[model samples]
Target: MRLFFGLDPLAGDKRAIDSWRQRVATADGRPVPPANFHLTLAFLGEVDERHLEALCDTVDDLALPGTGELRLDRVGYWPRPGILWIGPAAPQPALESLAGDLGRAGQAVGARRERRRFVPHLTLYRGCRVPPPAPAEPPDLPFRFRGVTLFESRRGRDGIRYEPVAAWEGGGFSQR
Candidate 1:
């Protein structure tokens, strides 16, 4: 099955992204839905059922320091073959390190090694096409990081449906 690890954007947060995207789209004549906002950790191309299960188990054992609220910041495009997005913005070092570590673990577990260096950004869109016009300088948005989720992505009618297969929460501080 095709799978990847990522931080899921919550429903409410998605809405916020959507609103910002709408404004950008209006100004640039293109927009992105909130559904597209996600920070990928690793891309496990294809794995047999057994290997897939092993991956889930491995992920289940992993944990993260969820101490800070991740703010969605920055909006930029990858300009090369065409216009692609980087985020809703850049990720914190903690987030970037996690992605890199996951990439390494995936390789050790017999997963395919990714050729591209992990760039911590949420992909907005991809195509040979470009926006009607350059977007107004991408807006700055922010969000809080409540926890990290281990999602099981599957093909669905609309697109890829990512369900949180397993998750461990440990970011909030204990206060008296």
Candidate 2:
């Protein structure tokens, strides 16, 4: 099974993001679905059942801190122009450190971590469609991330269906 780790955006914030999705989709003559929003941390390729269990153990062992009360207030797309996401507001050090750990830990288990490095953003839409030309502006929307979730993506009839496998509380990391 294919697996990946990521931070899920709040449902309320997602409602705001869906507005942008609608605009972009309408511009492209299609309707972008809102059920596909997510902020990926690490993309782990195909894994056997045991390996999947190992990944869960890795997550449990690492116990990466969540980004408590984090902000995501910018919108943008990848260089290739296939995905649109909301960028975090200069991720806190703890958030960065936690992302680093998530990447490294995934690598430790033979997962291919992104080479461009993690920027921490919520992926609004990603598929075969070209992203609408970069927004000449930002959403200027303010929202908080109070939790994170791991998801599994499977291609469905309409598009990829993302199912939540697990979630962690306390988003921005613990002070300890």
**Best candidate according to lDDT:** 2
Off by over 4 Å in 1: 26-33, 60-63, 79-83, 86-91, 131-134, 171-176
Per-residue lDDT value at 105 in model 2: 62
All candidates: TM-score: 0.74, 0.75
Off by over 4 Å in 2: 20-32, 89-91, 127-137, 170-176
- Global fold similarity of model 1 (TM-score): 0.74
1-176 in candidate 2: lDDT tens per residue?
Answer: 56677766677767877875555432342334656666677776665555555565566656555444456667666646566567666756666677777667667767777677667776665542655665654565545555556677788787667877766664323211
In candidate 2, where is summed lDDT lowest over 10 consecutive residues? 23-32
CA lDDT scores, all candidates in order: 0.58, 0.62
Q: For every model in order, what is the number of clashing pairs?
A: 10, 7
RMSD to the true structure for each prediction, in A, is: 4.9, 4.4
lDDT of 2: 0.62
Query: Who wins the TM-score comparison?
Result: 2
